[model samples]
Target chain A: MATDRPLTAKGLATRARIVAAAADLVFHRGAAQVALADVQAAADVSGSQLYHYFTDRDDLLRAVAVHRAAELVANQGPVDTLPALRAWVEANIALIAADNAAGGCRLGSLVPQLAETDPQTRATLSTAFHDWIAHLAAGLTTMTATGVLPPTADPHRLATLLVAALEGGILLAQAQRDITPMRTALEAALDHIASLATSP
Target chain B: MATDRPLTAKGLATRARIVAAAADLVFHRGAAQVALADVQAAADVSGSQLYHYFTDRDDLLRAVAVHRAAELVANQGPVDTLPALRAWVEANIALIAADNAAGGCRLGSLVPQLAETDPQTRATLSTAFHDWIAHLAAGLTTMTATGVLPPTADPHRLATLLVAALEGGILLAQAQRDITPMRTALEAALDHIASLATSP
Candidate 1:
């Protein structure tokens, strides 16, 4: 919870429910368009339950941002080697395909739909993306240490490209209702990274 | 116009004005939340003036997609050469910097913001992207033809990555209020393409 108040396990579950419902509503529809009443109905929570978890709309959105950030970051697996990165990419593609490419990037779908977001919420979302980028960067750094890639390869830059391929590819997938764009984008970025491999 | 009826020059100007305003509105605020009335006010046109140009909202969005597509395509300078593509990237970067990184990609900005778009309208937007993708692919193909790149270079795939970088990079730029993500993404893709060039 964004609130510092201690929560029981049941209380934590309820808060998670509200945030999940709020995230879904905000993703399909713009944040400015989804009302508290809609979130309450979707979560099957009383107004008291909603109010107990969040103080206001900004607070709720911030919580959603935080929750989503953690989820997105946690979703990434190993990326310290070319094979591992390929596996990671394929796993993500499978997830999207399983959803029939309906769900865009879990966090990215919410970014553009937000209107008049507070600076704090915006920062939270930005930090979430950066945190994900840092994780990928860390893997690339490990690859360098393991002699999988040349030290000349900039992990930060490569990671940035990989993440963009993901965010942008998902957008393309949503538009075309096909996974080719996403797959191609990810492969291109991965190829670029693999191109930096130290000849074994 | 998506409508078959041809318009006079002044009519075309009015229609273009309406689209630019509507695109701006849709880019910042989601399409579902933006009303026809709001577009009318933003464009400073009477309701008749608005309806005279568009039969309804879907027609208007289709027009906006068309208008934005043409504009984005025209914005790309010659990309048949590596240097030309680099220059193109820098020009785009300067444009974003000039705006203080406020505006996102010209076409991609409206994509996720639209909710429940009509099929025809969605197809129009998709084709618009494909057109840009084709343009970039054509450039890479030229490289293969001119022997700038080897025959093994896959133009379509490379081009997809390039456009993804642009769209995804811009999304990152919007989130971070910095141009480095977009720059890094474009460079990484460009480097991949450049790496395909045969040794001179």
Candidate 2:
């Protein structure tokens, strides 16, 4: 989303380039306001070239949603330790601050825009988040093994809470051009996680 | 905004009626998708009547933003005690459940749609949230007064955190068509708050 994820320059094929341009447009203008002409102009691709990449608007939108969701998971880093996770939140806070809290959480921003509008894209997004939750669940599970977190901690639930807090805080932060909400939410989540750590 | 507040039957004036109808449209369809013609039809007001109430589409969207923000604060109930504050969260969780998390949040849903695109409405929303934070801060301050919260709790900070958690959780919940995230986020915030309670 907006908070993290480094773009992979491994593939700059015509199709991938189009998706990247579309994703950027979606991030700035939102999905509904983004038009294919706009995407084509932004991508510097001809009509046929864009058509070769996608069937229609809905298709391009689904691509944008999937691209962002997958990128977020792919970019997620190690969190087997509480410090790493806190650093992740801090890094996200940095993102909001860097964007002046105006750019918002790129992936999280899509949820409100598309959740009700597109079922197919929504399903695509749902799977990505499911994988995201699983990825987080696995990391937190490892923490329990390393004795970083207490056995009583439910990795799955904590993972979900942390993600929610991150997205919600970003949303709030964006509303006011302030990072305090994002900072506060992340701190609260991290502190709660710290509280569950093996004392000392 | 979607999760709480009862629409008052108190004011059915033409202006208020138009704002209410416009608000509903904005909730279902993002503000970008809400057309002025739709608002007029929805409000059953003539074009002139609509113009009489709103100078333009942006004006009406701003009205919707302002209306929902005020409604949330106006409808907020007593949260002087820890239980009451949590009850508010529970009530919000119930809203996501009742709406199947599909309808999304009315106020929060606006953040992504307008924060960057429409500065005036964003400012309108910012003011409402400021008032909301103040209202919540006032309530949380009372909790410290009544010993419902420890003196260690920063009411303003905690209030921002709670709102952030709640919005973040709801956004996450809506993404998956699941209430688990919302429940998890809210419970985590309340649990943390409870942890700071004056020992028994």
Candidate 3:
């Protein structure tokens, strides 16, 4: 019943704009400090327009979480080849570095804030991560099938560590505000992952 | 001037109680939502006593961040043996899992919140992390020297990844509300770490 109506083209555009603004504001400020008015102001939309796009702030936040999740996955890049995985990881480090540690792992940040207080919001975050892990798992599976990884390398386990390590990199990077720890840590993780592929 | 005075015994006890209460509250409730009154209520201290212990709420938070940082490093346990490392990780996961993902990482949650807005606060969080990394590096370096790990292994790099992995694992484990990912990821990371050990 809740999923009944699909927004039209114009409506979808407005929704996207709101989500983008909300995410940027939350990243810079914080979810706690951001007001609904800030979202409308940043998006350059009227209050009525904001309400039209989403019923309330929570709805907008959920949409923002979805938007932010897409950006996280998108930043991983197209790791089509074994070498591409390294490139993807380096690009990820650069992307994180560019944010100056101010912009954290979007889905990771939002998940902690929303997970406990709101069940539906928690579910939304859980779904975002589930999709993220699935994408990674699929990538690892393809690499394994391509003989880029040894038969003993479990794609699921490798993918789990990949996600874990990347998130870990982000945590340290943010704390230090320097990319070295994040870069060094990730390179080591990639090296570990690559070591599994070398013999194959 | 700030570090000049030796605190009275009563002052020390009051400050300790306040810090402990603040840690518990902020760790459970989002830090931003936590108020002085909440800390006072939780600590069973009066408003004046709270202010006496901490000049302001930020002071209390900074102290809590430091205390939590100490706890974080302490959680790593004794690194006297390889089996101890394994046991430390196991206990850490159990501690995190027992919380049911309701309370996010205290230092991590506070660090990002401070990153863009407060330089002093950010530095405080950074200091905590620096201490954490240092302890880890010490253990890893010892492992290398004792021939538990290959001399070729960069203990610094490995230690850096280990910290990141633990934070990431906690984040994921909390989100999934399942211990499997955290345990699996940590074990895999440890396995990778152990693979570098020189066989006796």
Candidate 4:
């Protein structure tokens, strides 16, 4: 059974707005820098209203993590084929480039700060990453089944590596305020994947 | 010219102790959570003593970053050969496992939290990473010059990927509290390097 009760349409809208604002603030400002009042101010909601939607700051932070994870998954679009998978990887790199490397991967940046400090937030972020990796793995599996990749290719392991490379690249790019590291890292990951293709 | 004035032998020891204590606190507790008082308490120094050693908290943080970076470089030992490089990669993964994934890479953990919010900190971290990449690239260059690696292998680019993979793998391992992702990701990176070796 679900822990949270279903909300009406109006309640859902207000909750979504609060989450969006919180996510924005947390991403731009470090999580530690953003307080409940900042969230309330950004969301344009009163104190009682903020409490009504989420029990406390930690609860809202967990929600923001989930919201950001879902946004990343959705933005990735579909990835059932090899070309589609490459596109998915490129799209992530493009996002960093588009932002001019100001902000790195939403999950990558936030998860590190919270993972060791808070257990609950760590679990939320871990599950989010596992789910994202699963999506990419499914696409790699399709590639193997469709004869694009060799039978020996392990989709889950490969997917994990791809995610790691992307996160690492994003971190480097953000620190340097340049996108070359991100691009080169992702391209290297793609080349590795290509090497696993069935030899024609 | 040097920006910081030279210190007496006793002063150097005291400053090193302060930095070591602050680095420990910041590593266990997030950077934002550790204050100057905590650093002073941990380092066993008075208010004036702490301030006299460093201009402020930010200066101390930059010192910690530099100290941690040097520690990592020193701990990595020598990485002149392909075997040496593989050993370096394994040592990093071993570090995550040894800590039980409690705290990730010391530099990796702190850099992300500070990089986006503070430009000066970002520059410090970027230089540290660039220095790290340069070290790895130097090893790869030796491999190429010795004819161990193919001439076509770009040492700088390959070094960048290796660093990226290592950081990414460490982040993933810390989040999941498991070392498999890091091991797998790094093995894939090593395999890529092996593929570049020249034939006997």
Candidate 5:
């Protein structure tokens, strides 16, 4: 668990810096390879300050996971229609392409490493994904309510599938060092959702 | 590079045992967390024996990745038609459920960790995925040749999408600790392929 003590504004700023630094390192370098000293150097915080913010490396990792989830959610904003969902996916693909398809999805990259070994961390990630799916589902629900999608469309299920396909596409793209795989996979997913449209 | 020396029958057995044990450890414990001592203890091999087989942990990890790819390919057997493809996907879902959705795809789990950090290992995993994708594409190609799929269907693209969705679905299911996400994602992929049928 993270520290429960109250923090001043400066302390909060310092904590956020540490988490951002840790998130970058963990995303590029695997969690097992990152050390507290690395985080300290990256964040330019003293040893005592690092310990003050996080109880241990695991605690810091939890913070990084949360930070990443928040960043992803924030970047995605809201999705209230199929075009919004498609644009959200395109943004993800564009991000990967911008990075040369080198690193995959931040959450996707971390979950496989930590999900089985750390139950608490896994739960945090799972909740992040659940919330993410819920956000997408909410958009789909609106589309259905507005009569854009067929009444038979299950927003929850479709949203889950969209997220799943996106993660998988990112993985394949990273592995192949190309964006086409990701693009094709996501295109198929969006097409599937469009097929659920009432006019289709 | 691995050792260039030829191994006797007994030597081959020892090397295979070390890789198998390492694969098991890396599957349950993240690659970074599994130590040399853990590999030695799990394989019941002496320190020198471990070093003699693998120059370092990275080498061992590469071997494990290859071993995992072989195992996955062997498990999938063949995919020559839409039904065969569906069965292949069903088998993957069943394997995850059998493990209680504890550990996701071995390749999916490892690719994110090592793909960015190690180029050689990334290449190994990339080739494995490429080969796996080719196998699926072969099935789709056969379907097209047999008039089951329309000429408009690009086997390579569809195969890539299928793999991407499977990996993504497995990641979501593993994170959520449920099989529904994986099942749904795969069902969508298979359905997409089915929609490419000549009549459809």
Candidate 6:
């Protein structure tokens, strides 16, 4: 069991701030370029205070990865029908636009950077992906169960394709510095999915 | 126009060897983790010789990206019919498996790494992607012209989806260290494409 060190109300707020700032930097600046000092400055915490809250940089990175994974899952939300799928997709695009171009997917960025050198980091990345896949698959299963999709469907396959399409669409969107390709590609994918449903 | 340096036959061979070596390392080791010395040793070239071909590490990276772009195009080959498409995909999977998970992707790995910070590097990556998309699109157009696909079918859309699907499939395959997902995903996607022809 892990030891429990209760955080003060102020302490909890500061730590949250630190993690958010770290995520912004890691996503925009690339995890490797953002140092501990940078995270401290962004969080507006003193060096001693930052160290006190976290054991070290890796501990903080671990936290950031988990935070980003949850955010990624939360970003997708739920899906009911074609319109719901479209709305979910629109929200996702807005999430990217809100970050401008500085932040691509945080978990996506961190995985490639650490995949080669750090085993623990790789495991963190893998877990994040597994969580993400499960969230998507669950949403897909729900869509099928609710009769938004036909019973003769493979949620896992659809979930896999959806994730891949989004990631690939994001890649093109980032390259072109425009969301049209991303939007168009995703819309087409959703259309494909809609065709799978029995007409209401 | 860029200057074309005069080279002996042997010098040309040496340059190809170096680029191939770097390509292998970048593919298997991930680009950021590879060192100059490792490339030097693998290529069997002296330090001076390596520098002679590429002005710096970034230049060498540019070369590798170019080489990879060519390799990607070659791997996709000429897409004509169902058999051709299957062959092209299987060839790509075999190539990835040969590397034993060392190389995830060349341009895919470099895009996020270079785009945010370096404009010049970003330009190179953008060009590589543009070339790749054009190659796939051209092949798709031919397939449609041959009456294998519908006249109303948009080749560009299918091309875009093909690229997206491959990238996404590659990501999953890398994480799981299994080729099954890649194979299954591609087959399913191809099945969808065939469905387009039969749809009433």
For residue B59, model 5's alpha carbon misses the true position, in angstroms, by 0.8
Locate the minimum summed-lDDT window of 10 residues in model 3 chain A: A72-81
User: Mind giving the per-residue lDDT tens digits that candidate 4 earns over B1-200?
Assistant: 01267788998899899999999998888787889999999999998989888888878888888788778767757777988987888778777888866777788777668877778778877887888888888998989999988888888888888888888888888778888888888888877788778964
Fraction of native contacts in model 1? 0.53
Per-residue lDDT tens digits for candidate 3, residues A112-199, read 5666556676676777667777777788778877888877887777777777788877877777787777777777777778878745
lDDT for model 4, on a 0 to 1 scale?
0.82
**Chain B structural similarity as TM-score, candidate 6:** 0.84
What is candidate 4's lDDT per residue for A1-200, written digit by digit as tens?
01267888988899899999998887787787889999999989998888888988878888887887788767767777768877887778888888877767788787667776678778877777788789888988988888989888888888888888888888888888899988887788777788778854
Q: Which ranges of candidate 5 are over 4 A from the true structure?
A: A1-3
Report the lDDT tens digits of candidate 1 across residue range A1-200.
34678999999899999999998887665465678999999999998888888988777888887878888777878888889989989998897777555646667766665522466766776788888889999999999999999989899999999988988888788777788899999998988887889874
Report lDDT (Cα) of residue A113, candidate 6.
59
Per-residue error for A17 in candidate 3, Å, reads 1.4
Model 3 misplacement above 4 A: A1-8, A73-80, A198-200, B1-6, B73-76
Give the distance in Å from residue A62's predicted Cα in candidate 4 to where it truly belongs.
1.5
Candidate 3 clash figure, as a count: 0
lDDT of 3 by residue, B1-200 (tens): 12337888987887888899988887776676789999989999998877666778777777887788777766656763578778878777777778765575667766655555566667777877777777777888888888888879887887777777777777777677776777767777787887777874
Best by DockQ: 5
Worst 10 residues of 6 chain B by lDDT: B99-108
Q: Which wins on DockQ, candidate 2 or candidate 3?
A: 3
Best by lDDT: 5
Pull out the clashing pairs in model 2: A1-A107, A2-A106, A168-B168
Docking quality level of the chain pair in candidate 1:
medium
Sort by DockQ, top down from the best? 5, 4, 3, 2, 1, 6
Tens-digit per-residue lDDT, B1-200, candidate 1? 43577898999898888999998887665565688999999999999888887888878888777777788867867899889988988887787776545546657766665533456655766787788889989998998999999998899999899888888887788778788898998898888888888964
Alpha carbon lDDT of each predicted model:
0.80, 0.80, 0.75, 0.82, 0.84, 0.70
- Tell me the spans in candidate 6 whose CA falls farther than 4 Å from its real position: A1-9, A46-50, A53-57, A98-103, B1-5, B99-102
Predicted candidate 2 versus true structure: per-residue lDDT over A77-138, tens digit per residue? 88778778878888778877987888588888887788777888777777777777677788
Report the lDDT of model 6 for residue B115. Answer: 62
Q: What would the TM-score be for candidate 1 when compared with the true structure?
A: 0.91
